[model samples]
Target: MNSFEKDWRFTRNSGKGFESAELDDSSWEKIDIPHDWAIAGPFSPDHDSEVIVDDPIEHTRKVFSHPGCTGGLPHVGKGFYRKHFELNLKPEQSARVEFDGIMSHAEVYCNGRYVGGRPYGYSSFALDLTPFVKNGTNLLAVSAENPPGASRWYPGAGIYRHARLIVAGRIHIAYCGIRVRTEGNRVTVRTEIENPSARKVVLTTRLIDPDGNEIASCQTSGDRLFHCEFIPDEVRRWQPGNPVLYKIVSILGDERHETGFGFRDLTFDSRKGFFINGIPMKFQGVCLHHDLGLAGAAVDRDITRHRLNQLASIGCNAIRTAHNPPDPELLDLCDELGFLVICEAFDEWKRPKTPRGYNLLFEEWSERDLRDMIRRDANHPSVIMWSIGNEIPEQYYPEGPEMTRRLCGICHEEDPSRPVTAGLNNVDDSITGGLFDAIDVKGFNYKPYIYARYHAAFPDAPIYSSESASTVSSRGEYSDRLFEESGRKDNLQVDSFDLCCADSATIPDHEFKGQDDNPFVMGEFVWTGFDYLGEPTPYHREWVRSSFFGIFDLCGIPKDRAWLYRSRWSKQPTLHLMPHWNWQGFEGKEIPVQCYSSFKTVELFVNGISMGSRTRNPKKLLGAYRHVWSRVPYSPGELKAVALDEKGKALAETSVFTAGAPEQLQIDCERCGNMVFAVVSVTDRNGNLCPHASERIDIESNGKILAVDAGDPGSAKPFPLPYVNAFHGKCAAWIRNPGKTLILAKAVLNGKTVQTEITAEA
Candidate 1:
């Protein structure tokens, strides 16, 4: 296998003969694979698309109040890419090219000849290039386009995932053809082959444990598909927090295929959540979108790992790839990191949600896409369930149940080991309409109040909150007055202290109580684990673009809500205070103090004086997990919280200090291939980031400055620039390394400059 990721020329143009093998593409932008051109956006709402205006009365699924729901990025257009390579192969050997993912309708060509195409943007596909291959130099071309208003959130344009070239003999194994299933003590391995000469193939399978010891071996001979079984003496089960893995090395002819797998006995009970390896456990999951903040839809390994690690730190063990399928690397990471996964397929079915949504392509593409997703991910032990569709409007239609049945049947046909589920918004209508009985597990989306009602009515149906806790907040944002809490007057900063959620969704407290009260119900996957681009609720104006639903901000910074979750979900003791004690204008005013702690009681102190000690009242809303001193007077110095056990002994403590004026610039950086991001924020004298600092930061870099983003979704000040005023005291610059040398980036604020340098290896 050869990576087709590097040395590609790209252009945002459309015309015939561009795919010609002899065409000169020297003027096109030099780039690499796993690229998203849309993230370097103008973010102009003025782009040629029908904009949706804010509607005050109605709040629906994927339908935000405003028309700028898609992050107002330039994702609605066509882009072309071309690559050249030399290849020489024997007559018996053929070749194929694989694309991990594309944004939308993609047409691939080799040597100026059209080979294949896939309409679904998220599905991974491979095209046979043997038909168009030459003995020497060959040219490959691909065109990708994002239709106007194709998605509700940011679905980036171009090839946003890695592409590869695979060459194999005529008797080689089929693509994603190896399947592993564990039953009792026996394990079965099925292999599909592509033999043109009708050769009787000998398949040798070896099972290796995590410690790399070959424990068992099996052999089979067949002209068609081969099946091998092995019953190891000791079985290692894979579970969250303890992912015991094993590998299968299969040999057929000269082809050697290795796969990683784990043996697990998983069963779901109506009265007792899910039992894995005979141990019952609740799923503390979170719904994650494909975008990687400033990286857009491009798959970055480090950024993706960082985001997942943040969720894992707060005790999130399961993941739901919201609305669509995910990159294959994500599943590989989940397997290594011990995260239970729900590999979702579609966001819509036959019902249309947008102008050119997946509804139009459902008939021709849904089945094939669903099959490919299962085939590619079925081997991963982390995958416990397959989600068919999410919040689809078909739930309200008369024929919804039949479609659900059809999809469920396809899932069982493809892989029967794991159960299939769908995120249902209308639980009542789904149950009464027979939609509930069509699938294996019912995923309740944002209706915490009906947890008891639905369970009581359908006693045997296993249920879990597919999406909940959409509470919105901006990190480091707070105000004593309710009027200033709105984002407009505060640099688009929503109040962290005054938490609000959507009409369909509830806060963390509501979902917390629901999950805590109903032991039978499987735990909830929060609406989002991180704040994402677009779908800004409550403040869905044209200027505002990114949602505030995440426990962590867009840059992966933890918000105050992260503390609340850590207090509830984590086993390690946690004590976190909220809302920085920096009220200048509202001195002596009543400031509500809040803290989330694992201990039984917590004492609040202000300016070295004890306010009071408080304990949670389970019967009261938000009082079950949070300690509050709502009437504490604000006097800027320090506010602290000391967690005490039932014996009144202080076990843990945390403090929040009032920040001074911005005095310096602090910078952190991370590299993604040739691109490096400089995250810059202004800090006070005590080295704390001043939340209100909107200082204009000018950056001079030895390398080329590609783009600047302050995690502000509304700011449309052209991303391909070098200077920007900080938003929430923070902004980042994307710098491209020109050569293998030290690249210094200097940030100047108030005529004071601070610099950081990195050496790019050759």
Candidate 2:
């Protein structure tokens, strides 16, 4: 298997005879397969900007609101990729080329002959190369074209994912054709063997547990379709927190194939929400996009693992791939790490979200794309739901019901184990018109207000907030003013302590209590858990690089809201205080304080003076539910909160104090093999994090520096730099190296320079 990530000849300009094997291509530059040519260009402002008038409601290019600002980078036009290879093929072997993903319009050619084409960029496709191969030297050329305005966000130009050549016997186990299902103590294994050779063969199968022990075996005759069942003495079920997987290996004469499956029993009801293996659980989930900062559209396993682990650390139990299918590796990691997954298929259906979006090609590609996504991801135990579409405007059209039924039917035909769902913004149309009846569960995008009303009307349907709480805030920056299309520039700054959007002031808290009051509501997947590239709505300044809707910033660093979610979702005794007590103007003045804790009551202290204890209100008002310590006199000293359980015994205590000038540097590193991420933080003399610090820090490491991510969406700097300006006194550098490695980071502020070193394990 090959990713073809490096050593490729690329050109942005179109040329005649470029796909020919004899063409001279030395003028073209060398690049990697998972490369995004546009992000490498200088940032642009006027590219995706719209004109503002008296009212922000009448803004142009309203469709751009979907994916956040595209980081003001070029995502359109055409680029060509060519890979030259020489492989001696066996007479009985057949070859094929597989593209995991590509950007927009892609056309493939082998040895100057057209092979196939893909109109939808997100879909994974492959073409037979047996008819076009010459056995010795082969020139595989591909041209990817994504016109401007073709995408709703920074779709990343070029062959932005893995591509590989596969050589196998003509009669072998098919790709992604193995399906496994478990019930009681018996495991059902089904295999689809490709027998184009008109030859019959005997196939053998075995089940291997996580301990690498073979527990069961079976034999069957292969005639394109084969099935077998193995009954073990015991079964270890797969759950959200404990994902136990077993491997199924299929053997046919000399051909062999293996895949992993989990033994799980799932059921859902309006009252119970979701249950895996008979245990009720809430999906403390987040919606994640496909792009990784600096890495662009390429799916790096290490980088992807880091991002998911970051969410897991903050108590994220599930993931919803916002609008499209994610890299296959993501599901593999999810299965191992015990994360529930909702693998989505598309962002739009028959109707176009953008003037030139996927709908233009939906007529021909939707079914195949949907089939590929489902087939590729069906075996993973982490996948609990197959989301058909996200906020599809087609749901309101005349043929809505029929279209919904067709999509859901396709999913059922492909994988019957998982239920189908869609993120519907038009709740009234979906439920009243019978479109909702086609899906097993209903998912509302931003309609938490109508959840109770919907439940009252139709109490039997399992429902969840497929996407919710689009709280917009910048890391560290604070502002009391609100923003508009023609609003003041100062309104763009977001206050860390007051992280709430105009749509909903008390986010998560408001939605949290709704789920508690309505047991029928499964749970919600927030609009985002991490800030991502593009869709820079509320903060669309020229230099802005990312959307600020995540609980964590772009660099995977947690924001102030992260603590609140942790306090609400985490099982451990959680207590966190916000707003550093270094305010200059509010000296000795009473400042409204808030604390997030799972405990029943919290006691507050100001400079060693008891500020009294407070408990959550019995009434479910937005302001009343969130733990608030009204009017605590502030001083340039310490402020602490001690959490107490229902009985009044102390559970946990945390403190925040007036910090001194930044005088020290701290770097914490998490290493896995050659990939390492060093979190660089600027702190005060007492080792307290200076939350408001934005000092530019230079980074140097004894390793191949892949990227530096700071999680600052409003910063002007691109994410691929060796140095980064700390956002909320924090930033991180991603490095790739083997053996013992060291990283040094330094920052200068107020005539003082501080440096820190971090060493990664070999």
Candidate 3:
């Protein structure tokens, strides 16, 4: 039997009272293990007393427009939580405490010796309290305090993640860490079990196939070092489109733990793009922060899955867990759902921050934190890379390089199987001083044009735009400035004037534009996937419920850009249109027009009169058109468009647009291609894409049914066929044609079909 098992105690603590005081069962609040204090009770409008509580309209207006204040009510601090558990340990067993995550800072005591304290909000840390823990009737005390100046961006106070008391033998298997090395079809699995006990013991490791079948197993014995290996004939490789994973289960006596690992190799060939298991695949991924919408720091498995499903719907294949190690649930969800992930560590460099920076360096706590994250998440096949930090001290810290080196070294030391990386905002500094050499792979945050520059500087280093913006407008303005201006400057020159000017000038616009004009860039994660609450913007007065940059709203509603992304990423047939209303001059003319569709052609009608028919663009797979009527038509009536296929089958239709007066319908096509598109701008006296007085153009097309492909929106290659049909139609046929294959034949109208000689070629 293990020696550590005797000292284990599992009891709940009421996270109330001051840090110095001991918490008893009576003082503890009886709450579930996984809970979010911010989302605990009703969203009371009365709670606004703590911040600024005024008129609802005024509050909403100000919250959306301003920064520093998220118009929503602030979270009430000083909460309590408690859970109960039973431990049965033998004489030889020793005990340790493990917590998946705790928000802000926490002080833990096992039977009153003050086991340890942790401040980092995102990462997990464990404490050894074998000396203080008793066999029976032991009380575990934890005091969780919300920092005074904690981020207003929804930092849920108290113990938001899972907590457990691990009672195991001294020679027990450590938290499962599985590594698979593959050479072509041949693969080898290496399993490590940490034996902290004085006595030697045998540890058995088994590989569980996807079908719950044990493919292989091996055994080794030792108190400090135990290793095992296995080779399988049929190995499954994990990829975005084809995600396959095998479970690695390590058993020590009756205590068994399992982790899923993908046995695939990932490498980047500069000329050919990224390759997973020797097959070239694009990194169509997105950057995701830790928050789960309004749920705050709480780890919600369902919510996480919902977000992943939403991302998958838009064809996102990869996920960068931005700035910090997300809840373990997220990694597990990624593994199960088959999305590639970049597991991240911290938001800042060296130390954490004034509120709590990376101050816990060289301490036992730091080691425990790093070890917990790595060992717990090591087996997840979705995690392709382990990021050490995000935008860490590029220009401010003199010891930036040293700090990076130390972090990289620590990450490698903990888990050598995965490559270590840090998100860099300043690629110029990284390339010039060789500061990025410490990392196995270099990651740039905002720069898209530096791919060649980095390749030229470090010929052998593997690099990626870790945090490229989906669109310049999505990241605001200065983002482009940072990318463009930094490249223009001489590598050796360090001019603060130019840098300052560039930084100040680049401000992101909130308006949505299609994809940016950069294909050389491998992949880009839109700043966020879901609208996370707590991030305050100067635009919204109430605590902005979610980040404006997300493609989806907090309620998981798809924004206009999401459809745009779907149209670009997935090869599914689609049609989308934006209605224009509230133009300046035209206010009294009935321009009743309908956009009608079959499977391939779209028919437009004005004032109940057939106008014209347009064929879908075979190459671009998109179409747009407009129809106008004069003063003879009654002012302000429904204008619609319907789309159809070659057989004149109705595919989809558009919403009604009331036209007023004699207004000009102006069309603007952003990209010129085979896809027929028109941005209908309704102008009164003058012409513009009027926000209020404008009506959107309807689109219709037919070909084949398309499935939604998951991938990164910014850098995702345009699908051969469009995927999003915006006319609220469920089924639409799409034609698949890469280039000009069939020659133009003839037009068929009404009952009359006109025929012309056409040549069909591959």
Candidate 4:
């Protein structure tokens, strides 16, 4: 496999006949793979096209010119990309190009001849280039179109994932043709082959242990199917707490395929929630969109690894790729980093949600896409379940049950080892229409309100909160009003108090109780783990271009609510306070404060004076483990919280002080391979970050600038530019390494320049 990523000429919006190898593409913009043409937006309402979205505030479903649902970017159009490569293949060799993902309808051309095309962009596919290619030089062209109103959220444009070229002999293993399954101490290996000459190809399989030692070996010869079984001396079972993986290498003649899998057993039980390798535990999961903040829907392994690490740090053990099939690299990272995953297939089946949604081609492509998803990802140990659809309106359609049963049957047919589920928002309708009967596991979307009632009604059904808590908040912004039903209409920010939840959704604290109240219920996956590019609830205006449903903001910075989950899910000692100490106008007034702690008792101090000590009250709605001091006097000094164990020994302590006026800029650099993420924060004379600051910052780097963003979704700021405004006190600049030992990033604010140097690690 060879990377087909770099040196691609791209033209956006308007183009024709560019797929021809004879056409001149010198004027086209040069770019690399895993690129999103829509990310660098000159955001404006003028780019708006009407798309129907769920609006609970209007009391009924309505449609209007709400471009915020798609991030108000000019993304609905054609994106053509062409690349030239030298591949001198022998007569006995065959070639194909595999795409991890494409945004929408993607058409591929090899040397000006149409090869293959796929309608659904989320599903991965490969196009055979053997028939249309020449001997020496070849041109590979792709035309991907993101149709207007095709998606509910910002479905990024163009080839936004890794691409690879595969060349194999005529008698080679098919793409993703290796299937590995484990039952107890036994491992089953199934390899599919393509033998044109009806020859019995020699197939060899070797199982490698985690420490790079060959533990088992088998030899077989077959024309189509090669099956082998091996019971190793000992098995290292995979668990979310400690993911240990083994590798398998299969060879057919000169062609070889390598894949990593783990040995583990997981099941969903109606009586005792979920179990991993015989031990019962909750699935602390989050629903995540495919977009990676600055990277848009384009996936980067390094950047995604950092995001997954952050989620794992806050005790998130599982993930549900919300509403669509995720980038393949995300699953790879989840497997390596130990996170359970629910590989979702589609947001809509046959009924159209948006004007040009997947339903437009669901009739022709639904089964193929579903089968490809299952076949491509069946071997991953992290993917314990397959989610067929998410909140599909088909639950109410007359033919919904038939389609549901068909999809479930397809899943079982492709991979019988895993369970099938769907995000059923209309739970009653689904149950009544036989859609619920087809699903092996019940997935409730924003329906924790019915967990206890449903468990009583169907005691034998295994149910989990597939999509829960839709809490909305903006980092660093505070509000006196706890619950803003419609959110704040006056500003581009939401209150960090985490009370501004959507009407269709409840706060995180409420869902926390929902899971606790019913021990038989499986865990909940929050509506989102991080802020996304679109589907901005409550804010239909063009200025609000992203959703505030995440525990972390768009820049991957954790909000105060992260502690709320850590306090409950994590066994590690955790204590955190919210609402910064620098409320300029609320001086000497009563300010409500809240602290999330795992300790038995917490003592709050204001200006070095003890306010009081409080213990965990299990019956309280939000105060069970979250300690709250509603009437603490605010002053221009310091506030502290000390968590104490049952015996009154202090386990952890944290404090927030009143910061001085903004004075300087601070730069912190985090490097992942050749990519450097330079974070610029506004600080006062005492080096305390100003949570409310939005200072204009000009940044420069010795490396190439990939993206300059302060997580401002509404801004039309050009990403390649060096100028940005710190959003919620800080901004982030992503740079590509220019083959330097040390990379320098400098930021200027208020005539003072602060720079940080990063060494390229590995």
**Which is the leading candidate under TM-score?**
4
Model 1, position 753, has a per-residue lDDT of 65
| Alpha carbon lDDT of each predicted model | 0.81, 0.78, 0.51, 0.83
Off by over 4 Å in 4: 1-3, 51-55, 60-63, 647-649, 738-762
Which ten contiguous residues of candidate 1 have the minimum total lDDT? 481-490
Q: Which regions of candidate 1 deviate over 4 angstroms?
A: 48-67, 481-491, 667-681, 698-708, 717-724, 731-751, 754-762
lDDT of 2 at 391: 82
Off by over 4 Å in 3: 1-28, 40-80, 92-95, 150-152, 176-197, 350-368, 395-397, 436-440, 449-463, 470-520, 538-545, 579-762
Q: Which window of 10 residues has the lowest lDDT sum in candidate 4?
A: 738-747
Once fitted onto the true fold, the runs of candidate 2 whose alpha carbons sit more than 4 angstroms away are 1-4, 48-68, 479-491, 502-506, 540-543, 620-625, 645-649
All models, RMSD in angstroms = 3.1, 2.9, 15.3, 2.0
Winner on TM-score (1 vs 3): 1
Query: What TM-score does prediction 2 earn?
Result: 0.94
Best by lDDT: 4
lDDT of 2 by residue, 1-762 (tens): 255456789998756788998888888998767777776645666554433322333444443332235677766678888888886778787788888788968899999999998888878888888889887888899998886555655677777778878877777777777888877677888898878876777889999998889988889875798999988888898887778889999887777888898988888788678888888888899999888766666677888888888887778899999788887888899999899999999998878777678888788888999999988888888999999899888778768788989999999998887899998888888767778887888998777678789888888889998987777677765432222222224545555553455342235666777777787788889878887877764654345767767888777777778887787677766677765676767777777677877777888988888898888775845344457765777787899988887887888888998878888889999886568888888889898888778899988988988778677766656656788888778888878887787999988966887788988878
Candidate 1 lDDT, tens digit per residue, 70-126?
777888889999999889988989898989898889999999999988888999998
TM per candidate comes to 0.93, 0.94, 0.67, 0.96
